[model samples]
Target: MQVLRPQTSGNVDRVLDCHGNKVVLISRRRVFSLTAGCATFLAAPYLSLRQSRASDAIELPEVRGGGKIRIGLLWSLTGHLSVIEKPSRDVALYWIDEVNKSGGVGGYQIEPVIMDAKSDLKTYRSAIMTLMRDEHVLATFGGYLSVSRRAVMPLVTENRGVFYYPTCYEGRECWQHIVCTGPLPNQHSLDLIPYMVRNYGPSAYFVGSNYIWARESSRNAIEWLTQAGGQLLGEKYVPLGQDNFDVICKDIKNKRPDWIFSTVVSDSDIFFRKEYARQGLSSDRVPIASLTTSELEVKKLGVSYGEGHILSAPYFQSLGGATNAQFVDRFLGSRFGESGVTHFNMEETYLAFLYFKKSVERVLQENGHVPLTPENVRAFSGGLHLSNEESPEGEVHLDPDNLNSWLKPKIGRFNGLGQIELLWQSSEKVSPKPYLLYPERGVCLSDGLHLPNGTIVKAAS
Candidate 1:
């Protein structure tokens, strides 16, 4: 509710675009955006990541090696993924710009060999191969969908190449090659389902895109809900980018579940919510809860459509703290300009690079050159700790066991003003077991519990 209203800060120039919903104010060196919720202003003193030198534009290295650090940037910039996955790509570039501008990590300029997956499975595999075999990047970063992450992960492990994947994905499959920056089922779904059962209602419905991330997460959501004294009314999955949600929306209306949990992606995510609103449904009656939804999705869907929708993640733009305030402002100003918005997708990716920077610098300091191998990165992960104080998120504890970080969990609601209102957050970061080492289910069954398709594992005694 507390908004920093703009006073006579300086001589300001107002810019109006075709998108009339939001007004952007551009000043000499600062910019502020008037959004549907809170009016956001430039945080000021944003450190320039990339230099303006003519040489910085070239992505491929001049000589390939020559004592320079190279990072592989992979994300879907075009085709089906252009809407949801591009931010992951941009943030990777943002970090590369930051590292290179600061004279690089340990005296070597970092160069990004950027590749677009085009939202295709085969492209994801092929891109990683080129980054490792041809370009010989020190490490690779990017992967939005769990299916694509699953597809490309094996290739990275086969080559023993390090990958910094940033996406809130399904829990299971602890891969040796990936350092996951995204939250898992326990961090978001299990935590979210329990909260809803106690506070919102005990009956819920599940909807998702027809993919591994949505389907598997839905299974865990079912387990968590059942254990929490809640009942699952229904579960369904639609094809990716299936926009016509009339049939599903009609089905849900008839079902009359207390709340809805959605793992839908891309176009389906945006369209379903719009149709949800068009069906005369409001969050007060039945709010849509999601681990995949972010600020960007909300912005695109318009504030009115997602007014009371709930989102649970490690970070949010409205997360009040000195660190969060500083990062959010600089990121919005530098990356997207005054009119730009911040989302969890880019925030996690941004934080991942910052965490990886520490390891890269450590490797360079210990050995004269940055070793381009997964083993070298894994060796330094134990020594590396990304303090919650440094990031917009409270803290990130890097768990070397599964190569996934123990992230502090937070839940928020898109309130009346179209801004995220903090509902709940853990005081400390919780340890994660991606392969279901310690589940919320009381007894860790040696035989392992199985749902429709997914299995929940017990901890090792």
Candidate 2:
């Protein structure tokens, strides 16, 4: 019902709701590259029916191997979502390349038939359908935002597709088809907020994008703050792709809450950090805490803009184990090159890809062959016991009862070099409870949200 207006300035285009939330859109050049180090090409193999059927259908380079395993990837590389999605794409390619070099899941080369949804919900919905109905992918790994995942859930469920969604989100669903490899509310909001209430103060402000992830996360934030005996100062939802945070930042400055919690994603996350700096707010004054601001966004904003901020997630580039150090060096060399930075979301997706790879192996080992079918893929994933050592994160195992993984939780502070400095870590791996039942002071009673651990009371939402 709302018509989007073209932007008069800047490269990214966006549609704004009357209340100031962004709707993402992309241009039509139609070229895609799997990784930044690779060559760009028209992704003909993953094209829509119209594009692939046209007389001038593009030809792709031939693979030298037999029985290549096709997996679908849906990410936004050219739209506003690209800010967050590009790194995930690069990591996916690099990780897959490594897997192939090491024999690749029962000797089948992993070929990701990549599709750029370009931040359009319709494109995401149709793309998942296309991958299933047309490409017949064995399994799929992508969808960074909650909205994108929500778009494809029904299709994935109805058609029996195995979708690995790797992002910290509002924990409100328990879809059987999706294996969430990121932290839920108990792992993040409940853990981080109580820490804030004890260390920072009781009063806090809430800021986020006007979407399901933000809305739901903020609602969970309210419940946790109240349970922890903290008071709400204010709450605001800004346009997702909005370039200016002057209005929201000014409100927070006036309120002077002990801390500001944010769920702003993609470009808006970076914008708000810079604006907060410009507003002269210091960590000692009113700290900014976020579930969405990760090493990727911190790298983009730089330490000048991103420093002193706090992030709560399952992994950070600075977690510094022998495994983490090796992964960081190798991944940085292959993709980032000059910028030695990565984030929780990128690592989470990388872990998701590894889970899929492990599942393929499990299916093959048990059934004698890996079938390129959704039922087979789901069964394999449903029974997998993924090792955390293979991942930079420590001791990860997927829950068969729920599709999410038991992951370690950590809080980090960004430094001058665009890296997360580790602050605190959970005592052990936390269970994945997608439907959060909150927790009690560091121990999960009902479910730390397919999460998350701590003695958090179940969320009111």
Candidate 3:
């Protein structure tokens, strides 16, 4: 058997000088010699060895045989808006699991690539780019905070990809690549403001988080209020995660408006409610009507703080209907145990994903296995109509131009025990008006109190 030998360079001068020309057999078969001349070449095996070790360290999902559909779920999983964003994330996963259980859209199992924005605009921008470029996700459904949505909208439009945003927002922006599943200002705030003023009173104070959604929504409210014979008491803006409401509370006390109309979002709402209670102000003394606080936030506020508070939204957990009941049952049973359904964003997320699935299915059925391109999704979405009993505002219709749903808004009063009961609902669908619908009118104001005598008046007036 011929043994493989290592190649080595012969240095006769060193050997002659050191060994004095002694006869010595050079084996030329050492490990160091074997690796010398081909050091770079030797690196290949070592590099591959390191890579193999790394491969063993990390476990990755195997790409399933046959067709695979990639969908991205980008949401604010951390930072200020995580309370709302986390539920959205969970609901997105729920929809993905549900779709896979039902044989998926167009016969391919969905590969969900979930990314966390961490409530940072830069992270949101980066996440969307990665989802589009690296993951090659066909479509994405996420974003609870309007600021984050606004950050990613330009990128999605430029890339010509589909981004379905599922939070209620100020409706001044519309894009070709974006589908907004949440109620717009017109669909929620515009109608709600007028109704509250008409039924309650016209003296209103506008309070909100210092963001595009709050600023724009508050502006819309001001317009509607002014139009409806309501007087504006004062306006204040707070940072989203702000803890200090002492100044704002003192201001509210001094103003003593019949009602405080607020667009405060996320944990800021909780702080406002707690501060309101701390100031010994009850809904009866000076009612606080908000556009953003929902069943989810109310739960977080607990019974004492949230009770008697009023909020306007398109849906609530207590909404009575077979569809809503089923949704509530499933959601609560799986997540919160037999009674877990609460957050408005959770329901909105469920609706968004279901709507997308319905549209995608329709397109596949009509177009015959045409892969889900953005254009195809848009076309399919144009003809989409979704109605369920769980929807507090009844049926929802999508607008072709804006790709936004026309849904009614419902008003609810928190009964202090974390239970929200519906008080009012739009009799008909409210269309999406991205621009200011009632810029001159502003928002309606009231005492925020529902009196037994059924008498309501504008506080400022």
Best by lDDT: 2
Please, what is the whole-model Cα lDDT of each candidate in the order they appear?
0.69, 0.71, 0.67
Q: What C-alpha lDDT does candidate 1 achieve relative to the native structure?
A: 0.69
TM-score of each: 0.79, 0.80, 0.78
Summarize candidate 2's per-residue lDDT along 1-461 as a digit string, tens digits.
13256563343344553324333333333333222201111122122323334454322222223588777777887678898887887788778767777888778877666677776666776677667766667777888877677667766765667788888877666566787888888788878988889889999999988777888888888988999999998999876577889988899989989999989988888888888889888776888899878777766776766777788888888886788888888988873333357778888888888788777667777877534466666666754665646789887877775677787788888787767788888898887655555432233222222334432332212
Q: Whole-model lDDT, candidate 3?
A: 0.67
Pick the TM-score winner.
2
- Judging by TM-score, tell me the better candidate of 1 and 2: 2
List, residue by residue over 1-461, the lDDT tens digit for candidate 3. 01133233451111221213111112111122111222332223223223223222322112233577777777765566777777777776656655677887667777666676666655666677667765667788888766667656666655567788877888654356677777877777766777767766778878888777778788788888888888998999987677789998998899888788888877778888889899888888777787678777766767777777787888787888788777766766553232244666777777777777777778777877755676567567864678765353358877765577778778888885677888888888777766556333332211222223555322111
**Mind giving the per-residue lDDT tens digits that candidate 1 earns over 268-375?**
798999899899888999989989777778877788876888999988888888887877777666643332566788888887788777876676668755343555
For candidate 2, what is the lDDT?
Answer: 0.71
